[model samples]
Target: MPDTRHASISVDQFIPAPPAKVWDALTKPELLARWWAPGDVSAVVGHRFHLQMPGWGSVPCEVLEAEPYERLVYTFNTTWTLTWRLVVEGKGTRLLLEHSGFDLDDKRDRAAFERMGKGWQGTVLPRLAEVAAAEG
Candidate 1:
């Protein structure tokens, strides 16, 4: 028997803002464009959208779940599930991002998983924090 588990990536950040503010930044097109790619993202389930990845072009996505200022789950390029969990802590919020369902058996998928793990931590998360700090 061989291991048959999918690879996943997760990044956690503590934002000095409330869950509502963070939620707005995550869902609003203008705020998201400042940090991540420009997309018509919303908290409505089943709404299709695309994120303009700098060098990768537009990545198709769909909202799978939306729980107001709590949790958001969406699909990424029809390849993986991206989940954002927000929790209120003190006067701030704790954001946990989980990108899962990487097919480890595929070399290209594995490579992408590794690259995204670093990208989320080094680039995406930091930019999101900057936006939150500035806007919150």
Candidate 2:
């Protein structure tokens, strides 16, 4: 039997902007292309997205659910699923991100998966916050 244990990494950021502002950073392909990949990289969902990282080449992403300034969910490589939720909080908005579905026995790949999770925190997400704050 294949190891199917699920692992999820999530991040929450409070951006000093409205929910719509933060939501645009997620759903807009232009904004996504800006910070979807790590520095000097780019991404385009519903089309081919090539990453500089070896063994992590072009992958297709199908947008599963998109509720405007509320939620956006999509599948990467038809295996990993990522969901982002936005909630209004006072003068800012709360952004919740979850990336799940990875192999349990593949330790080598696990590190890459974990690094992607961290990327959302260290890179992609912070830029979203900055963009939102700037628009606020």
Candidate 3:
């Protein structure tokens, strides 16, 4: 049998802003485009959208769960799911991201799992922090 084991990416980041601001950067399409892909993203369960990534093109996504400034869960592309949780800290928001549904036994999935892990930490989250911290 194949390994069939699953892998996931977890990113924890601190944003020098309130939960509401960070939440906006996640939910608001315009604000989100500054950090992430451009999409008609909404914090409403069952809402379907597509994110236009430069090299990746259009990625279909659907909102699964949304709890305002606390949590947001959604399906990315097809198999992967992205979950974001926000915890209010002393002077900012602590953002926790979990990207799951990686089948390590598969070559393509394994490569994506590895690359995205670094992408989230090195580029994505840092851009999100800057967008969330900006005065609006």
Candidate 4:
């Protein structure tokens, strides 16, 4: 059966740091530890991570895949895989992220997908930029 239940959300940011530096922020655990989650929340490979917001309950997550200086892919609830792409542009890096393989038939999971979309925009991407700034 052809899978018809895949969903993807993407966002791009141009960071002032070079691609290598930006990539390090994305791939290095020390850098990720600083900006991978929201507020007092934190993250590590193989750790069950969550992002705490004012209203949203802790959003549970795990790091599914990570490739140094190039790509990172991961799953939440074992349902979707989110991939991040970093490319050198001018003196900085153009970061592109894609979240895929969501189950369309499940409404609750769909809500999570929606939240992931917002989180990337409101939380993760900005934090990545911040990490880039701090990387200097």
Residue lDDT tens for model 4, 23-134? 7676555776677735221223465555443455665667655656677665544566667788888877888988787777888768867787888888878888888877
Each model's C-alpha lDDT? 0.90, 0.70, 0.94, 0.70
**Runs of candidate 2 exceeding 4 Å displacement:** 1-4, 38-55
lDDT (tens digit, per residue) of candidate 1 on 27-86: 999999999989999889999999998777999999999999999999988689999999
Worst 10 residues of 3 by lDDT: 1-10
Task: Write the number of the candidate with greater lDDT, choosing between 1 and 3.
Answer: 3
By TM-score: ranked, best first:
3, 1, 2, 4
Off by over 4 Å in 3: 1-4
Model 2 per-residue lDDT tens digits across residues 53-135: 33766655666777778887777665687788999899889999988777655685588676877787888788888877765
State every prediction's TM-score relative to the real structure: 0.93, 0.77, 0.94, 0.70
Among these predicted structures, which one has the highest lDDT?
Answer: 3
Compute the lDDT of residue 61 as modeled in candidate 1.
95
